[model samples]
Target: MELKFKFAIASDLHIALPETVWDHPSRFHLVEFSIPALEVVLSHLAQLNLDFLLLPGDLTQHGEPDNHMWLTARLRQLPYPVYVIPGNHDVPTVESMDCFAPYYRQFGYKNPSRLYYDCEVLPGVHLIGLNSNQFDADDGQIGWIDRVQLDWLESVLSRVSKDKLVLVMVHHNILEHMPGQASNPLSKRYMLDNADRLCQLLHQANVKLVFTGHLHVQDIAYSDRFDLYDITTGSLVSYPHPYRVLTYERDRDAERLSIESYRVEAIPEQPNLQHFSREWMGDRSHLFMLNLLTKPPLNLPSAIASNLTPHLRYFWANIADGDAEFSFPNFPTNAKKYFEAFSDRPPADNNAILRL
Candidate 1:
């Protein structure tokens, strides 16, 4: 059997037009060029004759009525099929969730329960979209796969042939992409609350690939226990803005997966953005690093954390810039050694082929 298909992934779009761009003191979203940035990517992808496109989620700035409207209209003009899921920012509240189904009615869902859907995207590929959004009493968002969706997923996967490729899509990390991703307080929110249970089921079903967003970092984390790969794409509006093109092939003789990543290096009005975005993020990394070091997994003192913040200031931007080879030789011994753990690369890094 020779199975081959081409697809593109662009996640965490944070598509904020001029009016939807809100003011926040601590916010790090560079969403001013969300539209133009997407246009640049779409313009490039439109010519590639892709089999399909996977948005995975964060399709809007804040699930704004106008923003969703803008994105839906824009996607309608595209040449290929697109499948989308909702992210935390897209469904922050229960009340705001009503608009998602109707806005993207054409994309994936078979009926009104449009938050999640399953469809046959190609001859031997099943595309499963899962909604990771749930609301708490305080109206805050959480990432979880509800029981109904899980049951539905099991039913769908049970029927798929073993030869068929299963591609899962969600808005949260399903694998630990960072050092303390699953247990660390600050990082846990970016991962699905019940990732282990979901992983067990997918692994049992021989699902090899899952597409996810919501860390705004480009990472490919494999589940040693489950034999699954969670390919997380970065945000289009953030530094080192990235998107991916994946090619998967399977035959009687071999099975292989290859990934190629590209960054939106420039926008119409933001010339030389690749150089300036790193500087902008470096300037703002102090508070973020302080919180990380003082929080769980490290628990360093505030003064010590502050002193260490500058050394690891570009740590996150580097992670977001995928294929990161991070090392800290010039820092204090303990801090340098501790931060190095997060930078370790997995065997299946980007821009390469892996035998399945």
Candidate 2:
């Protein structure tokens, strides 16, 4: 039998009900619209007859008890199944994992005690959710799959047949969507610490597709070495406020996958939300851009960085709004080249259908 299905992914919902939102003077997330924006997306998704929905991570603003509670209740109301993983923000402390399972138990978990889960989302198709939040006091909030989970993943992959399609969902990125994600000091936070080990295992198992979030960029990174694709979605409450719809199909001789991305441009009260959000990001981009230049990989002096900040004001916002292309002709050649690389958008950056 041939298997085909459609699914949606909306990452980093950061759902903050009115009561849970905190005051932050320099906050980048417009989390107040978390609920409405999600509702808008869900309203559209609900009509699509999706086989399931995949919420990769950052399901709440700060993993507040109330926020988790709210998200669980809302998720229960959806018509289709939903699968989730805990992000660094979801479980602020390691102990919070204890309470995580009960909230999302109905979603798709054989054993709540183990944060990672695997289930057959469709015939000959599997969905695996792995928790990447490593909260060790010495290690801090790094992305890692501990030995126990790694072993569990190995056992699970070992049992699957060669014809089956394995779709892995993790909170952190396994591939470098940005420049120097693994080696760059500033970009390491967005990647899995021991990604090479996991990639080797997946490659051996013939796993092709992975859905991830947390960097809040609309990016798809493919590895020719492993023949793997890491598709990361943007935040629901940040600039571009995007989500994705993916359709997978298979037949006797061919397997095909299609990906299409969409953005939440407005809520009920804010019809021009896209315009407003971009401006908000631009207004606050000065310090962020300055830090980007002075940080590792660039390490420009404070004064030099400050002078160059204005020209690249919407640098990150553009990244968050994916398929970004950057070109600078006026600046010094080296500085211009260094900053422009961030906007590389190949043909497969946004949407495409591939034969597997």
RMSD of each candidate relative to the true structure: 1.4, 1.3
Instruction: Report the number of the highest-lDDT candidate.
Output: 2
Model 1, 232-297: lDDT tens per residue? 998988888889888888888998888998888888788877777788788888999999888866
The true-versus-predicted C-alpha distance at residue 21 of model 2, in Å, is 0.3
| Candidate 2 residue runs with Cα over 4 Å from true position | none
Q: Assess candidate 1 and give its TM-score to the true structure.
A: 0.96
Task: State the C-alpha lDDT per candidate.
Answer: 0.85, 0.87
Task: Tell me the TM-score of model 2.
Answer: 0.97
Candidate 2 per-residue C-alpha lDDT over 1-356 given as tens digits, one digit per residue, 9 for 90 to 100 = 58899999999999998988976877889899899999999999978979999999999988898999989989989889999998888887767878787788888665878799999988888888998888666746789899999999999999988888899999999999987778877778899999888999999999989999999889988889999888999998898899999999988888888999888988986798899888888988998888878887678889988999999878888888888888888867778988788876553656878767
Q: Estimate candidate 2's alpha-carbon lDDT, on a 0 to 1 scale.
A: 0.87
